[model samples]
Target: MAKDKIVLAYSGGLDTSIILKWLKETYDAEIIAFTADIGQKEELDGLEEKALKTGASKVYIDDLRDEFAKDFIFPMFQAATMYEGQYLLGTSIARPLIAKRMVEIARAEGAKYIAHGATGKGNDQVRFELGVAALAPEIEVIAPWRSEQFRSDFPGRAEMIAFAEKHGIPVTASAAKPYSTDRNLLHISFESGMLEDPWFDPSAEENEEMYVLSVSPERAPDQAEYVELTFEQGNCVAINGEAMSPLQVMEKLNELGGKHGIGRVDMVENRFVGMKSRGVYETPGGTILFTAHRKMESLTMDREVMHLRDSLISKYSELVYNGFWFAPERLALQALVTESQKNVSGVVRLKLYKGNVIGAGVKSPVSLYNPDIATMEADPSQAYDQGDATGFIRLNALRLKVSAGVNQSK
Candidate 1:
């Protein structure tokens, strides 16, 4: 009888390599390695062959960039999601889409089990498993980092390295760089290693060497560059007057934002597993989008609608950050978020300089602003009536004056 198949989310990285080896040896099962190509650039090159060499029975590489941007990223941006008031939620938003694709591949291949390389201590375990449970509840999830058998077999990175050598699997990791990284279209995140310390300044040589998508702000060019982004119903449709796909829009912004040293953040955040982790992120294109998207909303969104949407920003951000992308609450919130963006279509001009994205100008066909009403230099007979403010102020102040008079009598 043939062994049962297990589909593993393989990245051609050190941790996943160890998992692939262990899965084959322990279960004697057929291992099918999967890599999602969500804009990791050239890192996907040679991955399929590498997985086969590392004991995978077969390999699947799927290009998921356009879906990643349009379905996942654009919706998150439409809601104006930001985690902990600073993070753009780049890494957090990519998890569900990857998990969704993994589940789909498992069903197609008739795999009974799936595996991932996320550690027990990190948020990814929650993210990967929650997605699995939601999408493929019957499929068993094999998490090597949390398994006692795997941990006993290889105590740490050194043992895993030795096991790879014994199996003739070439690995690129070193002891000096203990931190693991995950990269996709939106951002790259660095955690563990020297970054574990909250006080550790990331400007150290070793830390600087890890950057892939952006440069240091100090080294950015002296000149500034301007770019115009056009949105259609909350989706980025063009850049600098040229029509482009979502993937192309992100690529253009990444190039421009990287050149200007934009989008670098270091923060200590509360993890879903009841602990805090320090992470450094580089999200060049994501930062540019956040800035320009807000400018678009300012022009097209109604005042009360913007305020109501802003009220949900915290809860919405927490759901994304906490691995609840497939949860019912998040889906419902997204429905409202999507409706709120119906009129958010416009062009936002921005100035990109060293580590800064400054709004240059914004305009939209549906803009609520009227020069006749807003401009003090406009004729009093036009648009808004200035005389209406007298009754409006008295009506609003009635309760305040009553409370003040009652207090004075006491």
Candidate 2:
């Protein structure tokens, strides 16, 4: 009889390498390794050779960069999604895409078992498993990090390194440089290791060594640089008069934004697992896109409609952060977001200096802003609504006035 087959979401990183070996030893099964390329840059170097050398029966390295940007990143940006009002949700959003692809590969390869290296205490474990459940519920997920057998065998990175050593799997990381990072076209995220301390500031050396997408804010150029972006129906369509595809747009903006040291964020964010974690992120292109998208909306979106959409931002972002990208409620929320952006078509000029994304100007043919109504100069009687303020203020203040009178009488 043929042995069981398992599909592993392999990064060729130390953790996945160890898991790949452990699964083979434990299950005595055939292992097919799959790696998704969502623009992880140098991290993907030699990944195929590493996986095959490390005992993967078959290996797949697929490029999901364009799909990641257009399908996942753009929709989230259209909603102005942010977790805890600070984090750009870079890592959180990538998990679903990875898991979705893994499930598809599992089906194609006739594998019923899907495995990942996400730890129990983390949101990624939840994100990965939830994505699998949503898409391919029939596929069994093996989360080795959460299993008692694996955790007891290898408690930390040191044990993991030892396991790889015994198994003859090569690993480059060590105690000397001790942080975990995840990268994609949108951003690069650094977490864990020495970053666990809430007050710890990364040294200049660490920043320079680890940063791949952007430069340090202090080292950025003195002069500000400007770029213009065009949007139609809430999606960015062009940059600086050059119409480009979604992936091309991100690549160009990332180059420009990185040069100016834009889109660096450091914060202690609340995880969906109910723990706070410190992370440093560089989201050059995403920052430019988010700032420009909002600026365009300020010109074309209706005032109350914008406010209403803004009201739903926190909840929508929560759903995303909590790994609900494929959930029904999130789909409903996205539908509403789509409806609100019907007329959000415009060009927004942005000035990038250091880490700041400043909106310089915005224009749209469908702009609701009337120059005559908003001018500081004198207004005609027909345009003058100055007298309307008295009744408006009185009506709003009536409850306060009544409360004050009641207090005096008492």
Candidate 3:
């Protein structure tokens, strides 16, 4: 009888490297390793050779950077999704894409079970499993961290390292670090291990070296740098007057923002699994784009439409954070968000300083700002009548007057 095949999301890392071999041995099945290249930088080097040598029957390294930036990152940016008003949903957004691809590979490989290295404690477990269930309901998910047998066999990183050596797995001695990091085109997030303590500052002089994307604010250049962003229907299409694709725009912003030491965030946040986790993130490109996008909206978006969309920010962000990216509610909300951006086309100039994105100027062809109506000086056009405010104020004051009378009677 032929053995069942399991498709595993492999990341050429210690946990995934061990999981790949363990899955094959425990299940007595063939393991097909799948790695998604979403701008991990140099992490992709030797990934295929490493996976095959470890135990994977076949290896796949799909470059999903363009799809990730244009599809996932851009749409979320349209909604201005920031979990808790700070997080750019960087790590939160990438999980669905990875899970989506894993499902595709599982179906293509005729694999009944799909596995992942996401642990039982973190949000990735929920994200990976929920994404798979939403896409392929019939596919079985194998979470080794939740398995007692797997947990007992490898109690900690030390035991895993031992097993890796015994099984001829490749892992450097420095693999066991003080914290863990997840990276993609949008951002890089650091948490867990030393970051579990909310009081521990990752930006301290001693610990600041851990940051990978930007320099400390104190170390940034004395002079501020100016950048210009051009947007079309809420999507950034160019930087500094140069037209480029979504991926290219992100790359340019990341470069400039990183040079200016921008987009570093440290906070204690509520996780979906009923826990408060401390996370430090570096989102250079995302920060620049978000600021410029909102500035553009101020010029072109309607007041009521922008307000209604703003009201959904919390709910929309929560949905994405809690692994509901594929849910019907998110889809419906996305449609409304997409419609709201129809006129959000404009140009915004920004000043990037030490850890700051300040607005320089904003202009739009569809600008709702009319100098004739808004000018304080006498306007011959009389587009807005100053005398019209009397009746409008009196009518609006009626409710307050009635409430005052009622309160006096009480």
Candidate 4:
């Protein structure tokens, strides 16, 4: 008789490792561990060996960096999408891609069950489950953290550590260093553990090691550096006039933006689960992209179209944050966003200095800005008559004038 196979989304972290062991013991099933390399840097180091030793029958590590940047990050960037006007949706964007790969691997490996370590209280569970449902609805999802039996058996992290100890599973993190962190190419997010305290100021000493992409802002170069970003149909194509691929463009911008200590944001954002959580993020590449794209749009985008798109930004941001990336409403909004960017082609020069992204200048072939219409020095005779302004103002202010007259009469 053959044992049933379950594919686990393994991160080699304490939570996932413990869950991996627990799943193997509880289900008595063959466990296949899957890790998605969406630019988590050193986090992937020795992950295969770690997963295999910890009870995984086989381990699959897929490099999804190019796919992550090109498909997920770039589309979100093109939309100028932010979660609650702050978060760049770093972890949110990475989840769908990870889940998609998990489903693919499950199918290839002939696994009947797909498992993840996301807790019941968090948004990741929804994101992962939704992705799986969208891609492969037939596969059974076994979320250990949300399982009643698993919760009763372990109760908490202490019990999880005890289980690892009993099973001789090598666990690196202890209660002493309890903060949960999620890292990727775009950003690193810190939450849970010591961060639960709303009033607690993040211990600067403890957080010093958290930075992966750049040096401290205090140590950034004193001089400002200018860089030009070229875009076509809302996608960034080049940096400093050097044409590059989507991944290359992001990598180049990350290098430039990191040197100046750009894109570090700390905020308490409303989670999809109706909880307010504090998150610290570093989005160097995304920051530069946003700055340059907005500058380019200012030059090329029509005023009415820009305003209409701007009005929908909050709604769009909320949709991405709330794990609706695969939803029809978001797709409909994205189509409008893409259509709005049809004319948003240009080069934008930005000055990066000590965490500041300052717009230097912008130019576009499709620019709506006309110096002849805008410049004070332009010939007045060539433009519309000044006398037409009197009637225009009077007509516009008629209601206000009527109200004033009525008030005087009263």
TM-score per candidate:
0.95, 0.96, 0.97, 0.93
* C-alpha RMSD by candidate, in order: 1.8, 1.5, 1.5, 2.2
Model 1 lDDT-worst window of ten? 203-212
Can you write out model 3's per-residue Cα lDDT over 136-199, one digit (the tens) per residue? 9999999999999999988887788788788788774344464667888988998766788888
* C-alpha lDDT values of all predictions: 0.89, 0.88, 0.90, 0.85
Off by over 4 Å in 4: 203-206, 384-386, 402-410
Off by over 4 Å in 2: 203-207
Tell me the RMSD of model 4 versus the true structure.
2.2
Flag clash pairs in model 4: none
Tens-digit lDDT track for model 2 on 1-410?
88888999898777899999889889898899999999887888998898888878999999999999899998889898877877888888999999999999999999989999888888888899899999998999999988899999998998888788887898765776667788888898888788888677763655477777888888889999989999999999999999988889889989998998888888998888888888999889998999899889988888898899999999999887888889999999999999999999989999999878998999998998888788877775357678998999999999999999999999
Q: Taking the tens digit of each residue's C-alpha lDDT, what string does model 4 give over 117-205? A: 99988889888988888889899999888889988987877887777778777766668766778888788777777677767565365
Please estimate how well model 1 matches the true structure, expressed as its whole-model Cα lDDT.
Answer: 0.89
lDDT of 4: 0.85
Model 2 scores a C-alpha lDDT of 0.88
Which wins on TM-score, candidate 3 or candidate 4?
3
Off by more than 4 A, model 3: 165-168, 172-176
Clashes of each: 0, 0, 0, 0
Model 4, position 337: C-alpha lDDT score: 90
